[model samples]
Structures are given as C-alpha cells and as structure tokens.
Target: MVLPGVYAPQEDTALLAGALSDESLPPGAAVLDVGTGSGALALAAAARGALVTAVDMSWRAVWGARLNAARSGLRVRVRHGNLFTPVHGETFDLVLANPPYVPAPLGGRRPRGAARAWDAGHDGRMVLDRICREAPALLRPGGVLLLVHSALSDPGLTVGCLREAGLKAAVIRRRRIAFGPVVRGRERWLRQRGLLAPADNEEELVVVRAELPV
Candidate 1:
C-alpha cells in the first residue's frame, strides 16, 4: 500500500520484527504504537488481530499510517501528537516504538527529508528516553514494550533506564548493518558523548524488550 508522505520504513524495522513475539502477544490485544513513522510495526500487530492505536508527531506520518491501514483493509487508529498525548489514560497490552535515534550535530542542525525522520537529540536517545519514561504508565500489567534503536546510543544505558522505570528489560536481538560514510560525523558526536567508543567494532541495531512486572 502507498502510505501518503511516508516514503519508507526505517532499516531498524527489521530488528523490531525479531523482537516481537507473536505468541507473547495476547489474542485480540490492544496495542499502542508510539512514533508510527510508516506504521510498519503497528500494521503488523493489527494484522495479527491486535487493536492498534498508532501515534506520530508528524501529521504526514499520521495520515500516511491511516492511508496504509485503509489500503490494507485493516482497522488502526492513527493519532497526531507527540508520544502519548493523544492516548492519555489509555493502556495497552503492547507498546512498540522505533523512535528518532540519530544524534544531532553540535550546532543542532539537522538533515532534510528522510534523514530528519531519524535524527534524535544529542545523545541519540532523546525520543527513546521519553518512551522508556512514559511506557510504564501506558502498558497494562505484564504488557511488553518493544524498542528498536542504535547500539551507538549505549544499549546498557537504555536497558538501565527501563529497569529504573520498573520494567524487566533485556536485549532480545541485535543485528549489524553497514555504516555509510555519511554518518561519520554522527559517530564522532556519539563517541565524544561517551555513548559510543572510538574503537567500536561496528554499527548495529539493538532491539530491547521490556515487560512490566506482572
């Protein structure tokens, strides 16, 4: 389906796919999809019979997800708002997010178009941090939070953040992807922030699954 304004899904979507456990998802589950860029994960969950509420800060993204759902003949509620604003007081069995995770430059300038779609804040964890902070309240007891982001952003820190928020967190999957030279500046910024090391071996996508205590 041609989702309006969403040119493509993120490469990390593949990592998210591995993190999702179809069996762990309750039948007819209610799902909250945060940062529904292209609505890929949200659509997948809905297709599996979960009732989905997909939220995106971008109006284009919201309309795109709704278009995609219509073309797929699926029922998904698309909301335009940052994080969980549109779904206040609503809880779900699953909260999935593939947030903007690229660290911005020192001057705070960002790239245009699709590249802007993925640029997180300085440490590459701005949106991720917010999601981890907000997810606990949005999930029901025993519900799962699936997050896909870069290993360059300190996977340990991400896991720790989730745990501190009272969830059981673990790295469910990791996948390496070739880094293009275009992102070297970003790599350097991450290194300087101590989020990534100069000697880091490779670029990788990390999928973390955190579950609320039952």
Candidate 2:
C-alpha cells in the first residue's frame, strides 16, 4: 500500500514499467530503480526475476516501497537516501528512474510533504541533471539506463548529457498525456517560461534510453 506522502503509481510509472518490459534481461539481472516511490517500478523489475534495489530520499517513501515489496512477495532492497547515494560503488545491469520533473515556481523553499514528489525547481533540471551526471557510473558495461520525464524538461538536453558522458542515448518512447494536478497548478508559470503553449492542454512524456559501451 502507498503510505501517506509517498508518490503513487500513475501514468509515468506505467510508462516506465512498459519500457522495462521491452528490455531483455538475463536471469537474476541486477536492476536499480531510483526515486522508487511506492516501489512500483522496483516491484515490476523484481517480478521479472531481477534482483532489484530501490532508493528514495524520503523516509516515508522508503518504508512505503518496503511495505509494497513485502505485500507483493517481491524481493527488493529499498533504501533511504538522496538519489544514488545509497547505491554508491554498486553497478547494475539496468537502471530505471522516474524523478521529479515538474517546474515549480522560483524562489520557494524546498518542497516538502507530498509536493516533494514533483516540485522540481524552476526548469525541472534540478534532479534530472544530477541523474545524468551520476547514473553512468552505476551501470556496468553494456548496461542500460531508462529514464522518464516530461518534454517540458527538455528531453533533448537529457540525450545530450548522456551522450557527453560517453553513452549512446536517445529518446526511445513518447506519450502525450494531459497535465496532472501538479503541472496544471503551474500552468501559468510554465507558459511564461515557454515550456507550455497557452493552447496546449497536454504534455508529452519521453522515455530516454542510454547504454554504456562494452
């Protein structure tokens, strides 16, 4: 069950799960799910016979993921830490991330409570940029990283960052979905930033796949 203050599974979660299914993993492959709110993606990977580890900065999210893994009878090592800190020095065959990508208004205090799940700083790259910089180190040779985020966050820049890190990266999938409560709440700010057109009612989510060279 999803504990209070944990991010619940939604369109982005389902989309990431679908991408995970398309991957061909060996038996007992190692998988890492970053920001594993409610353990949805982690559990999905575990169900596919992967040895999954999930990390979140929120204590509530860590517990929620652990509880969901237990209820699902899935073996997932859930840890509490910001981003990749808990998994330092560990490499995986696959890494999955559905990080906070909403563009929050500038000059506000760091997000708290449920808002922490999506209130990314202005431009939405606060966490995404860190993932690009650090994720490659967590992948073994030929390992894959699958990341999902809104087009508003600039998927092109994500691809560029991964490629600059010596990985082959590209957008593997795209889905147009209506703005969620979070994005809708920031509609005016987003439009002012040219991230959203006034006539647009939907945002596109893109799945980026980056692969490390052998």
Top TM-score: which candidate number?
2
Instruction: Give one digit per residue, the lDDT tens place, for model 1 in 1-214.
Output: 4354553665688678667754377568999888888788888899888999999877788888898898889999999987899999999899888887777773666545555567776677777788878888988999898888888667888899999999999888888877745357566666777766677756888988899998
Residue 159 of model 1 has an lDDT of 95
Each candidate: RMSD to true structure? 2.6, 1.0
lDDT string, candidate 2, 1-214, tens digits = 8887889999998888899999998879999999999999999889989999999999998999998898988899999999999889999999999999988886767887788788788888889999999999999999999999999999999999999999999999899998888887888888998999879999999999999999
Task: State every prediction's TM-score relative to the real structure.
Answer: 0.87, 0.97
Runs in model 1 lying further than 4 Å from the true structure = 1-7, 21-23, 106-116, 180-201
- Total clashing pairs for each candidate: 0, 0
Q: Give me the candidate number with maximum lDDT.
A: 2
